[model samples]
Target: MREALCQMIERLVREEPGNRFPGEGGPYFTEPLIGFAAADDPLFTQYQTVIGPFHLTPTELAQHETPPWQPATVICWALPISEETRRSNRTETIYPSRAWALTRQHGEAFNSALRRQVVQFLVDAGYQAFAPQLHPAWREYPDSPVGIASSWSERHAAYAAGLGTFSLNDALITPRGIAHRLGSVVTDLAIEPSARPWRDHRSNCLWYREGSCGACIGRCPVGALSKEGHDKAICRGYVYGAVPEAVGAEYGVTSTGCGLCQTKVPCEGRIPAGKVSPLAVKPPEGESPSP
Candidate 1:
């Protein structure tokens, strides 16, 4: 099933017309990384507090089926943005580039279609599948203490699926890096969960592992990111607020994004080597070494 699903994702990125940019004729997502986890994984239950109380467990989601379901598994995938798009945004200091804005807005539409397609494929194969993001129950509550959080966090699911870990910027740092998006589906098939290589959620991050490399903090144009972590309200205001007001009118899109922290950094496309020693380079004044 994993191999089949991998092939399906490859085909979608390579052959799907909808995944292509309007005039560039290139794919929005370069390639995708897929992982699996048991439906009853305890981490899902833990996510209720980690994300929000509204988060649903696999069993709770399965109950929505016409006939109650049993044990299941979750298939999660990460879609890395194309280098061209990342490069475009990396060159900007204040607002998102046109490519970045389009990817964040239209690219999500493609992601939704991909989710629907995957669910349909699983159902057609005699298995009951559900995409929590696509479910009616899915909801997003802004301005939470934990930044802008949602009921079902695709990045958290991807982490449990062994796709990657969280970075200081709060983006999922997969093998392909933080400039990407994630999606997942829950199904009745009990597939084996992927191996989680790290002991802690932030183990893969250089800032957490070695207390060095706080490039993301410098990349934040609005000063939303500091040694403590990211300031969600400020970041959101810049991306969803100032960005659209400044560039949305010209781009013909309402939704805007800024991924400066994710690019022009060592961890943009892949994990960096061992951490830099604190003695070699000290963090900016007033900023701590901790991520």
Candidate 2:
């Protein structure tokens, strides 16, 4: 069942037409990395406290099925941004490149479709399944006391599934790197859980691990990152505020989010194994930062 499911995901991404970028830039996401966790993992409950008391566990959400079915597994995937798109965004100073913005828009529509497709696949296989992020009861709390948070966090699910760890900039540092989209599904399929390889949530992060390589801090155009870590509200305000009004409006970008910190940094393409990459930020000469 696990092998078949992984093949299904691989084929879906390989054959899905919706995975491409606008204007002939090719695929929006490379092949995704899949992982799984037991639905009853204790970490799910832990998220409720860390994210909020209202967060739902996979078993909790699965119980809402008509028969109050309990899920046995949580399947997760990381859709790494394509090399072309990441390269386009790497040189960006103020606005995300057109490729990046449109991908954030249309590419996410593809991600939503992928979620629906995964759910459908599990259902067709005679199992109960649903994407937590797509559930009607799912909710977001941009103004939460913890700063921008949600009732269910995909990043957290990815972490539990052993796909990645949290970074100082508050992004997941997956094996495929930080510039990626994450999604998950809860299902009755009884698949064995993947291994959690790290010692803790911040293990993959360069800053938190060795106390060096803070390149991502300077990559934030808005200074939303620092040694103290990310200011989620400030980051949110800029991505949801100035970005849309600026490049998104004039440059034909769809709704936009700035991920400059995710590119041209040490952890951009891979985990920095005990040493920072030479790709750490250094702007082109005389280029002024966005205001």
- Minimum summed lDDT over a 10-residue window in model 2 is located at 282-291
Q: What is the Cα-based lDDT of residue 90 in candidate 2?
A: 93
Task: Report every candidate's CA lDDT.
Answer: 0.80, 0.83
What's the residue-level lDDT of 85 in candidate 2? 91
Off by over 4 Å in 1: 143-145, 275-291
In terms of lDDT, model 1 sits at 0.80
Please provide, for model 2 over 61-163, each residue's C-alpha lDDT reduced to its tens digit, 9 standing for 90 to 100: 8766677888899999999999999999999988899888988988888899999999998889898899999987788876776887777888888888988
Residues 112-227, model 1: lDDT tens digits: 88999999888888888888898877778885556687778888888778887778888888888889878999898778789776546675678876888899999898999887
RMSD of each: 5.6, 7.6
Clashes of each: 0, 0
